[model samples]
Target chain A: MKTSDFIERLAEALDAESSELEGETILDTLEGWDSLGHLATIAMVDELFGKTVSAMSLRRCRTVAELMDLACGEVTP
Target chain B: MGRVLEAQGASVTAVAGYVPQGRLCNEELSSRYPEWSAEDILRKTGIRTRAIAAPDECASDLAFEAAKKLINREDIDPEDVDLLIFCTQSPDYFLPTTSCILQERLGLSTQSMAFDLPLGCSGWVYGLSVARALLEAGEATTALLLTGDTYTRYVLPEDRNVAAIFGEAGAATLITKRSDLPGHGAIGPFVFGTDGTGAEALIVRGGASRHPQKRRRLEMDGPRIFEFCLRRIPGLVHALLEKAELDLDDVDLWVFHQANRFMLDRLRKKTGIREERFAWRLEEEGNTVSSTIPLTLESAVVSGQLKPGMRVGVVGFGVGYSWGAGLIEWTHGGMQ
Candidate 1:
């Protein structure tokens, strides 16, 4: 999936705005950045990229860029 | 369901489940966590009230209650019970196997073979698989497969993560070696899968040799488990159908483990199994680990949802990343 598409899907997953969820956006500041949000993100990334992200990695991600990088790395690797 | 089966051994003739008297209704949960309402619990999990075992109640207590009920209700002589298998992640003690205690308490003959199986949601089918193999091998004619777990014992009452999802219960399933006219509830055509790599996905880290210092509390990653179920269960269903040489429509009832209502509904749509064909009646008992499948069967039997001459597809998945599936013909009509 393209970065832009991934951003939109991730926004939907986090229940945030696509425009607001830029690469630099702090994921913790989002309204849906909680346990359920982690679940949604995990599901969305696995569904879209065919990669399973460990919960620990998601917990470690500080920004949208890092999360995206993790998914991209998993998918590309 | 219409296909005739060859004479089979080890048919399940009776099933009974027992839940402790304690109750943890959703109202209480909503009171504790304002964000979660009673309606939300019912809507999200399809659980109204969860059965909790009292502090004094252990897994064996629940198992004994159910086993006694099945024995009396079905007029099964304890001596006739030649094989007793208890499946549980929670045992009365670490030294003596709980199955041995159950055998003596239930008045089964000392000669009766008794043992314990350590598994969670994947337990019932595994127990049935072993019982079927043993019975077919002429090791025993009567087999009683009992499953009981007090998961709530370890789950922190305040930890909504797992407390809300688990309930305590025990169940007894009687698998007798019989080939009378090749009728329903005949047990066979089994498929098993396991992945020890995902052992940490759903686990209790405190009790065993690895983490003796920590308390035996259940910790789970909901998303990981959800992904596992969504991705693997469809393959499991397909594999079972292929082994049985039947399609989804041939199944009279589809009873997956009563993990939760959401997962069951999602799997139903994902697998394209119709609504009426699936069973999701865990409104009272949340998730009883190994006992979920058999408890569901007992409930179905009482409600008349499960009748004789029906081909039922049963799958028990979770914990150990382990799973077992099989297509069985129901033959418990006369006993009920």
Candidate 2:
């Protein structure tokens, strides 16, 4: 998946507007970044990328860019 | 280790289900968890209201009520029941087995065999398979398959994930021997799989011999468990259909274990089963663990969605990270 596409999906999963999410967007500041959003992000990654994202690692991500890197890193090779 | 008997056919003759009087509505939960509105709860979990077992109630109590309903509906004499299989994760006590207590409470004969199968959500199908096997082997002519659980008893009110989904319910199914002829209501050709690696994904970590702590409570890794189900169930269903030599169209109703609305919908979509063919009645009952399938079956029957002679596919998965699926021909007299 392209970086822009992944951002769009992540924003959708979090119920946030895609245009509002940038690489440097702080995840903790997002309004909808809760347990349900975490699950939705997991589902989106698994469904779209065919990869399982560890919830622990997802939690460690401070920025949307970090999450994108984590997800993209799994799908790259 | 064992010898096989002359195989006979087995059929589920009746099914009855019961829930406690207490109701936990989304409104109440929404009030408790401000982050989630009632609409959000319903949209996410597909449960608007769920039954909660009373503080004084135990798993056996729910089982007894369900059993009574079945016995009364079928006019079954408890003594006539040769085997009693009670499936539950939340037994009244760790010893003596809840089935033994049920035999006495339900007034079944002392000569009748009784035991407990400690399983969670996948339990009803597991219990049904066991009962059918015994009947098919001619070891018993009639069996009472009881499945019940009070998962809410273990849930911490503050735990939003489990509290939003798990509900308490009990079900009773009567399996009887039938002639070895191809006919409706005949039960068999089941597929079962277990992955113990996912055990901790949905578990109570602090109880039992391994973790004997008083503060034991249910903990779940929602994402991992969701991924596990997504990874496993579609293939399981297809494999069962292949083993049975039946296609998706051959089955009339698909009754899956009610884990949650979101999971069930995803599974239905993944398996390519049409929405109308899928049986989903969790809006009012939530996910009642083992009792969900049977309860859904009962609901389907009541609503006239299921009819006699229809082939129903039942799949149950969860909380052992275990799963089982099978086909059964519906023949309960009420449906007729």
Candidate 3:
């Protein structure tokens, strides 16, 4: 998936408008980025990529770009 | 060692379920968790209300009530029951196994065998499989399979992930042997899987041998559980269908453990099964741990969705990170 498309999907998963998200946006500062949002991201990643992403790994990501990198890394292999 | 005699066939004749009078609706939950609306909770979990056990109520108490209803409904004599299998994760006491307490409280014969099987979620199907084995072995003629848990008691009110999802309930099922030979609907070909590695994913880390003083509430990793279900259930169902020598279309109904609406829907889609063939009755009762499958079965029977002679595939998975599935040709008698 393209980096731009990943940002849009993450915004949708977090219930935020895509315009509000940027590659450098810190995930912790995002609205609706609570435990439920964490679950939604995991579901979205698995559904879209058929790859299992651990919540703990997502928790460690510093920015939207980092989250996208983690997802894309799994998809690559 | 020369000849092997065929064991008698066994099948469940009746199922009864009971949830306590108290209920926690999504509207109530919504007020507590402002971020999630009632519609959100309902949409995600397919649960509008969850039954809560009364303050003084215990797992055995709920089991007893369900057993009484089953006995009265089926006109079964308590004294005639040969074996009692009580499945639960929550017990009334640590000693004097809860099943033994049930035998005394329910007034079953002293000669009857009674024991507790400590399991959650995957328990009902596991209990059903055990009951069928005993009946087929001629060790028991009539068995009372009781599964109940007050998981609400273990979960802290503030824990949104598990608190809103689990409810308190109990179920009683009667499994009996028949003289007829086994055929299409006789219970067998059970497929079971367990992964102890994921045990910590859904657990109460207190009050057990290793952490007696911990006294912590229930903790769950929602993402991990969802991933586990997504990876495991579809394959489990297909394996069970193959083991039973039946195709997806041959099964009349599929009653999966009522975990959550989203997960169940995902499994249905992944398995390529139509919505109508799957059972999704957790709208009011929430996920009652081990009682889910039997509760769904009871509801299906009442609504005329499930009928005698129809092939039903029952699968239960969760908590022990354990899972079991079986195909039953719905029959009051074992087989014809």
Candidate 4:
């Protein structure tokens, strides 16, 4: 999946209707980006890609960029 | 003219259940994580403990197992069955109905009327009403209605708001075309009501027309859900009783949706129904969503608490902010 597509999906998953999320936008910055949203993100990733990310793997990432990198297999955390 | 079949005469053939391997109770989860609490879980949603589904298990998996068990009975001809219904808010997938998966697994006749009922907690009664209608219409001979939901899949463990109240489970009941002796009567005019204005009160933010799964995760308004339950259930109960032409005392048992201890107690007082008239399994099974009512029925029968010829008032109210109730009279030793 494309990084842009993942970002868009993340935005939709967080219920962020219309926000220009730049590269610098924090994952938790969006409204309703709570624990449920977080788990949904992980679930989406797992469902799309054949991999599992523990709660710790998500907790270690600080921003959306890190998550994208992790999703792409470029970073461990 | 076709005779109306009464619920009291019908038999519950079998009941089977499934839960996620990972188990977490309110106190255990609370003590493990300082941020969560028994009271916090209660205030958010009046649930003491809830079950989470295993990573590999899906809604259909649980449903299929329950149906399989119910079908295992020698009296049920698996090949001759004509209907399969799944009732739950948590489905295996958004598009293909979970019943399809269960239908395939159960090796049911391809011609069976297969579908899923996307309902909140009040689904069991809702499914029962649908099954009764189908049976009365003579459209199907044997119908399998399963209520299986994994609400924990929608919420996070840290969400004491929901973590404390929900339990994952599946229960199935086999309704057949049998008209002899006590097996036939009136299911009575069913009573159902909804408040879409309070829709936000008990909703999983993701996975539906309004919120859509692609949009977000489940988010619920705890106090609003509690208030909705407290304010509306008693009125609905009285109205349904009026429709059935029966007094509260005439009802043998009151099986309210097992939302929580607090909510059940509050509703008991408001409805002016004595606590003894109510049947419950909240403490042992937690809240098993739509499965609560049927599972409680099975439990009551096994424990010798309920016997044949007894009438019970069954009601459910939750998520979707929906409410429904039906009066059923038990037919003991009826299931072969």
Could you report the Cα RMSD, in angstroms, for every candidate shown?
5.1, 2.9, 3.4, 15.2
Write one digit per residue (lDDT tens) for candidate 1, span B1-336: 332324347788889999999999899999987767788667666788889999999999999999998999999889989899999999999969999999999999887999999999999999999999888777788899999999888877567757778899999999986766455457769889998877998888997899999888788877678777777888899998999889999999988999877667766776889998887668887898999998888777777788888888899999989988998898777444
Candidate 2 per-residue lDDT over residues B1-336, each given as its tens digit? 543546778998888999899999999998998978899889878899989999999989998999999998788998999899999989888798999999999999887889999988888888999999888777888899998888887889779888998888899988987764466578868999999988888888767888787666888877677777778889999999999999999999999998887778777877888988999879888898889998999999999899888999999998878999999988875732
On the 0 to 100 scale, the lDDT of residue B213 in model 3 is: 96
Tens digit of per-residue lDDT, candidate 1, span A1-77: 67789899998866678988788989889867766567668767766676667777788999988998998885664
Model 4, position B301, has a per-residue lDDT of 74
Tens digits of lDDT, candidate 4, B181-243: 454333545699888987776666665687554644466654456556655777788888898
Off by over 4 Å in 2: A1-6, A46-62, A69-77, B1-6, B180-182, B333-336
* DockQ of model 3 vs. true complex: 0.47
Fraction of the reference Cα-Cα interface contacts (below 8 Å) that each candidate reproduces: 0.21, 0.29, 0.29, 0.00
Candidate 4: which docking quality band? incorrect
Task: Arrange candidates by DockQ, descending.
Answer: 3, 2, 1, 4
CAPRI quality level assigned to candidate 2 from its DockQ score: acceptable
Q: What are the models' TM-scores?
A: 0.86, 0.92, 0.92, 0.73
Question: Which of the numbered candidates is closest to the native, going by highest lDDT?
Answer: 2
In model 3, pairs of residues that clash are: B185-B329
Interface RMSD of 2: 2.1
Local error of candidate 1 at B213, Å? 2.0
What does candidate 2's lDDT look like per residue over A1-77, in tens digits? 67789888998888789999999999999977877778788777767776767777888999998998888786755
Model 3, residue A77: C-alpha shift (Å): 10
Candidate 3 runs further than 4 Å off: A2-5, B1-6, B180-184, B332-336
Task: Give the Cα lDDT of each candidate.
Answer: 0.84, 0.87, 0.86, 0.70
What residue runs in model 4 are displaced by over 4 Å at the alpha carbon?
Answer: A1-77, B1-14, B32-49, B182-186, B207-215, B334-336
